[model samples]
Target: MVDNVSKQERSNIMRKVRSQSDLENVVSKALWKKGIRYRKNVKSLMGKPDIVIQKYKIVIFIDSCFWHACELHGRMPKSNTEFWESKFERNKERDAEVNKHYLSKNWNILRVWEHELREDFDGTINKIVAFIEHAKK
Candidate 1:
């Protein structure tokens, strides 16, 4: 499918997209306030996890509903349906692969959906804290 924008324009637009999202920053700040120290988007990691605590071999992923194709909240775009579908499918596949890789290495993996955080921010943060604490054991 041909893109609506020129290749250079599309590249410029895509380049403006930041690796770390505001949602991630919010969650990370909350976790830090709770005294949890972690690294964000470690490029050396297989999937460049959103949060990682090497001390506990833990990794947390903050997934967006649109990007991760959340079962409850995900929706297809009216335009470029096929491209979006393929992109989402590949995202899901990569997520699965990353989970498998971490699990094989005995790393604790937590995937929090965007809606989960929006619906219950405190609860989600607590869950993440609990997950980290449990991994400490």
Candidate 2:
């Protein structure tokens, strides 16, 4: 029984998800400290990549599990299955387009789910580092 303000608050809460969480931030900081420089939230990019390393031509996207439909933890909401599935599918298609576009342009793309960030901070960073390092060669 929520009123307008409370309903709006709940909607806002549900709709909110930041690009760079503390886990990603910490990993970015560690990588930076080790002499890695990357651009954060480059709007010029089609997908607004979360992190970009120009030197290695690498772009990172910190995708939300709910939005990107993380294969593991992305459960279809039972409340509004049709609406949620459509939304999630659209997001997935858009992600594929962005990834393809970047690949065509010779830019390496990295998409890490929010769950991955929470579960494995350093390991996730390592995956990105490995890609960038390989591109560096």
Candidate number with greatest lDDT: 1
TM-score of 2: 0.80
Q: Pairs clashing in candidate 2?
A: none
Model 2: runs farther than 4 Å from truth?
1-11, 14-16
- The candidate that wins on TM-score is 1
Worst 10 residues of 2 by lDDT: 1-10
Compared with the true structure, what per-residue lDDT tens digits does model 2 show for residues 1-137? 22335667758976785655675677678779767788887788798887888777889888877778989888886665677889999999999999999999998888878888679877877877887788888
Candidate 2: Cα lDDT at 93: 96
Give the alpha carbon lDDT tens digit for every residue of 71-110 in model 1.
Answer: 9999987756798999999999999999999999999999
List candidate 1 stretches off by more than 4 Å: 1-4
The alpha-carbon deviation from the true structure for residue 12 of candidate 2, after best TM-score superposition, in angstroms, is 3.3
CA lDDT of 10 in candidate 2?
Answer: 57
RMSD of 1: 1.4
